[model samples]
Target: MPFKNDERELTSAIQAIQRDPTLRLYAVAKTYSVDHRKLARRLHGMQPRRDIIANSRKLSNLEESVLVQHILNLAAKGFPPRMSIVEDMANRLLATRDALRVGLRWALNFRAKCEDPEVIRSWFELVQNTIAKYGINNADIYNFDETGFMMGVISTAIVVTSLDGRAKAKTVSQTPNNPIKAMSQSTFIKTRIPRHQNSSPTSIYAAVNQFTKGASQIMHQLALLKAENQNLRQANEVLSKRRRAKKTRLRQGGSLSQQDAQDLQDERDVVQQVEQEIRASGGRKPREETRARRCGKCGGTKHNARTCQIEIDTSEEEGSE
Candidate 1:
């Protein structure tokens, strides 16, 4: 009986012969358990039987490798190729190769043969490793799901048009918050025809336009000025009350004398003046001049008695005398 052997066994036998040119063919054949004549034929560059070969694909090995790589690339971009897309791509590839177009059955069979669990696992691991290597976090990654709209139910024709000669007509209502409801052309024409026949042409064209940008700006300024005027009136009332209280306290012989009251009024006036100046200038008051501190002992502005050079020299002179 002839020895039956697979491609791997035959390939190993050929490699053994290549590695050691002096390697005995019979020994190589014995090691692989294949026929010596078959091994010799393989070594001479003879192709193996179709059943013994690993690849039985319609596409060449190189072409299939390319297809697998393209699929992986699409998967990495979060757009994994679907069966229909794969079929289209395969058909295109086949057309370039002058091969017959493939059907859905072929696509199903191709997927069944190539979609190995191991390959999927490796692809997932590769994506994870790449993300980790580049220090990518969950926040940096994004997923985009596709959405589609159905056009069958939507009307393609224009549903509304202005009855007037104007290309567009402005509608205004006393209630600004209410949304305008859309109406079809037929409903609008039917409803407006009676009103239009009775109404004058001037009335038909007399739609109120929206307030302009300049008008809105003027209204805002007016509101701000009203608030400021109210604030100023309140401040004047408070100042008047304070003045009245001071006069009453003076008449009652309070602890404060008239001169003291006058001084207090002067201080309040100065503060009010500073506030007016600040408001007019639209800025904070200027920093005050810092007063030089007087000495506790001699009332000298330069130095205190503890560190006074003049006092120290005078004491030394008195000791010498």
Candidate 2:
């Protein structure tokens, strides 16, 4: 409904609802003593109260400081604070405007030091503005980006209410809290290609699009391609492992002929040869391992990460001590 009211003529909207053949049944069951025509019209335009979107953290001109202090004050009193502790101070009564100022100021001061952090830069905003100004579709324009994907199931929120209706709690999973992974995959950009190369059939792959700036740009491009190639390689390894595991399972009750292993090795050699030729054509640097991981079995290196045999929860063990 509009903020202001003009009740001159019960709108056409009211007339429509009243005249609608279907609403007659519902309207008959529920009605006020008021005139039927007016009541029907009012229901047509009635709108529910809108809700505001709540965010964990926001830019600190002032209120940010206050919220931080509120959280901190709650923490000091041995109560769990509702607001995030990051870039915030502990202060009670932050919800009230008057009491939150001082704590907010302290938080603002601390935040100033970390103001230039990469996460705060808002890359999406920068990209938008740059595209608007430079026109992203220009012939010479090239898009560049870096990305990472999840290796584990990331945890999210769920509210658990007690049967008694007196207590509630939330929990987190062992996975890391990564904003990029969540936003990119869960939101509109459902699929991602780390980086891509433009290739044509007759000219051969990477035989297209040479940079004007010579070696420097070419080196950077090659490095990006290498990284993308490495990501593809890891995916290939994972796929191959899955295939091998599936084959192993299928052959569990059966015996493998010597020819089967030889055939597999032959296929692998063909793939290796093709990859070598592709790399030779591109003439780029090799891809490097992007992940840092510890061995699961006896803390030893070089093994399958998923099958890590160590069953200890180190974080829990430390807390217990």
User: What is each predicted model's overall lDDT from 0 to 1?
Assistant: 0.58, 0.42
- Cα deviation at 118, candidate 2, in Å, is 47
In model 1, what are the clashing residue pairs, if there are any? Answer: none
- Which is the leading candidate under lDDT? 1
Q: What are the runs in model 2 whose C-alpha is more than 4 Å off?
A: 1-45, 48-177, 184-321
lDDT of 2 by residue, 125-184 (tens): 676687788665643233222111122322122111122333222364212124453343
> lDDT by residue for model 1 over 1-321, one digit each (tens)?
456568788888888889899989988888788999888777787776773545435565435544554555556555555566556656655665488777655654563133679987886787688778977665444431111122232323211111221222135422122124212323444455567765664532322112222233333334434544676799999998977777787789776777767778898889988787786588644334245677887788878878867778888999999
Assess candidate 1 and give its lDDT: 0.58
Residue 139 alpha-carbon offset, candidate 1, angstroms: 38
